[model samples]
Target: MSVVHLHLPGFSFGDVPVLGPLTLTVDRGETLALTGPSGIGKSTLLRIVAGVYPARGTREIAGRMAFVFQEPTLLRWRTAQRNVEIAAKVSPDTALAALTEVGLGACADRFPDQLSLGQQRRLALARAFACDPDLMLLDEPFVSLDAAAAEEMMGLFADLRARRNMAGILVTHDAAEARRLATRTLTLSGRPATVTADVHAAA
Candidate 1:
């Protein structure tokens, strides 16, 4: 089963202090929504989970993972499908199919520069889903979209998670969105952020 456990001590990034101390667990099929004031090391936490940064405490990730950053992070030179194909290390057909799931099938041949901001975001989701990861790390995946588009993307995220049984950590500032998408929501506080509140969705 997919699982994650993190017990990171107070940490700093460069000269900037990040998180104080945090202990969290995510089991299979759980999406933990993390929220805080901007720049309170929300993304930093995701990076730590992704194993891109070193932390002082024990951290364990027990499954394949995929990440979707705040930015699309696509290759400007590559077509949408090609980008997913390369990053996900999947067949072209599989990549295209993932894009289709995110409503980007018709834009498969377009480059990142040619797609709208929302399309680029969808492309990023396509790449993540293409990997068929057990865990998903998402950082503001719905930023800069109209309400309708964001809602659609949210539905797509739910659909993908159900199809794959993926566990996830979503960093979002929108409380309502967090409540809508996550099984539980956590709020961080202080200079070196720590979880101040955790609320579970109603069954």
Candidate 2:
């Protein structure tokens, strides 16, 4: 099934064009990665697809969707478990299970400030998973983590994707990260960004 379909005639800032005409689709259980230079409108395109940014286009998304930003964006006053429960609108039991799945059950009572950066990212993943989304949108989700932490987080995400069979769109500048996580990658470039390359990973 097609999880997302976007046909963007174009997108622009007040006077400058950010993205040119484009069309893309993601199917069930597929991970599509968008890679491009910084400030090249990759994130902007993501927001447009998420309906967080208004644009003139045909944006169709099927089933439930969840987004994980570069930052964890957790509530500072809420405990880890509570963050998941509130953001995901899930029961306490479901939230706890989600925490456990992300290796955060032991720190469920800790607030965002108390957990390390990597742990906070895990909490974000837990919250997203608890929503039981059919499509997951991630924007540079592993940006600041150290090598080991990034690897672990990638592994966790891969496992979750396998278990849930969820479609995903990942935005990253790292080609290696895209190859590792995405089944297909689209590279955007030019003055008004457009897909310049579409490569499928070797199975």
Candidate 3:
């Protein structure tokens, strides 16, 4: 069932209009790829739908959801495994499982500093997956990675979502990632951000 829909009534701060009037829905067991150029407020739109945006309209979402920032902001002091288990809602076994699924099981005991940039981001993704969320919000889930590495990670994500029937709203600039993972692709327009183009594919 689709319970969450974001309705934006347009957003502007002083002289700058970030997103126009963007209204989008995150359907159950589907992925929506929000794409745009550099500062088009793609991330901002994700935040808004996640209820982190202070602007207008209401976001209708049910159940637990998780967000992965562009930067993998894992706790520096905690081991990768512990970082994934920090949320009480996430069990230790499940955390380890998520890390394992993301190919980070061996690096679980390593600190954030000990992990490479890609590993850290994978850890962040593992942490989010550990939540077993009904809705997953991702902003540039793949930022710094070689072409092969990025493709591999995207494949993993696709396999995981298919196995779990999880819904993801991902913001990315890469069209390949969008085609690989998204059930739908949308472009944003204006300050508060409104949907400019919406494309959906069959299962």
Candidate topping TM-score: 2
lDDT of 3 at 112: 97
TM-scores vs. true structure, each candidate = 0.95, 0.99, 0.92
lDDT scores of the candidates, listed in order: 0.90, 0.96, 0.82
Model 1 stretches with alpha carbons more than 4 Å out: none
Question: How high a TM-score does candidate 2 get?
Answer: 0.99
Compared with the true structure, model 3 gives a TM-score of: 0.92
Candidate 2: pairs in clash: none
User: Between the candidate structures 2 and 3, which one is better when assessed by lDDT?
Assistant: 2
Backbone clashes, each candidate = 0, 0, 15
Of 1 and 3, the candidate ahead on TM-score is: 1
Model 3: lowest-lDDT 10 consecutive positions: 187-196
Q: Write the per-residue lDDT of candidate 1 for residues 116-200, one digit (tens) a residue.
A: 8888888999999899898899999998889998998898888888887878999999998998899999899898799999888
Task: For candidate 1, give the lDDT of residue 166.
Answer: 75
Shift in Å, residue 33, candidate 3: 0.4
Give the best candidate by lDDT.
2
Candidate 3: regions farther than 4 A off: 190-193
